[model samples]
Target: MLYHIRCKKGDKTVRTIKEVVGHHFVQGQPGLLMAHCQNDERVFINFDHFDFLDFSNGWAKGEAIVAQKAAEAKKNEPPQPPPEPVINGPGGAS
Candidate 1:
């Protein structure tokens, strides 16, 4: 889901942040937003610059917020251990 963050605050045009992610506002950081952008870039943008945020899939605010929470929760989880390697022996193809 690509999101368009428009900076329509002032009279002049500002850089529009676009990516395959819903707009995620950073916790504990007022006016700060995080976006997963093109080329697999994770960017921290100033929300103060942008006037609006919209998901390409037409996600409502609540849905996007829920998605953001889920994403953040996943990120907070500890990394899992790699699967044990398989050993080839006379019993083969185990």
Candidate 2:
């Protein structure tokens, strides 16, 4: 199952766990230990700094979150200008 972790800080940094390798309790609260699916990186997230954790739909929710982020990023980007028209040489169409 996938897990989404949101930071309680003002920047609100978000991290996604494709798969949780292990977990432990911190002061009776749960903490998740995640390993990267692509690399050797590992992350440990404490329950205290978590603003939100979504595990309801797992994969589906993660996909929705990714799509939502992509849409938001696209919305914030400036409109791109169209390409200039190309002129072909005569010669009956080069």
Candidate 3:
């Protein structure tokens, strides 16, 4: 069956994060599945066995660390050499 994900009412909704928590079960499942939704209203995948706080904190820190590494890499990269002239007058050097 098809389902309707959440919809937004106003422009302000686009700028924020929204979360929905629910329990799901299948016909022969041993236990109900826990579900979550993000602002886009897309269903979030399970965390395996992580608690909510642990997941959130870990995600935030991971993102920060990744960004920091990227920034550091950019800062430490070697500068590019200037392009050589198309024509050289006499000397071997261009």
TM-score for each of the candidates: 0.44, 0.32, 0.28
Instruction: Give model 1's TM-score versus the native structure.
Output: 0.44
Per-residue accuracy of model 2 over 12-92 as CA lDDT, tens digit each: 656555444333222322243233433344665543455554443443333434544565677679999999767687654
Summed backbone clashes in each candidate are 0, 0, 0
Q: Is candidate 2 or candidate 3 better by TM-score?
A: 2
Worst 10 residues of 1 by lDDT: 47-56
Q: How well does candidate 3 match the true structure in TM-score terms?
A: 0.28
Please, what is the whole-model Cα lDDT of each candidate in the order they appear?
0.61, 0.46, 0.35
Lowest summed lDDT across 10 adjacent residues in model 3 is found at 48-57
Best-performing candidate as measured by TM-score: 1
* Alpha-carbon RMSD, candidate 2: 13.7
Rank candidates, lDDT, best first.
Answer: 1, 2, 3
For each of the candidates, the C-alpha root-mean-square deviation to the true structure, in angstroms, is 7.8, 13.7, 16.9
Residue 7 lDDT (model 1): 47
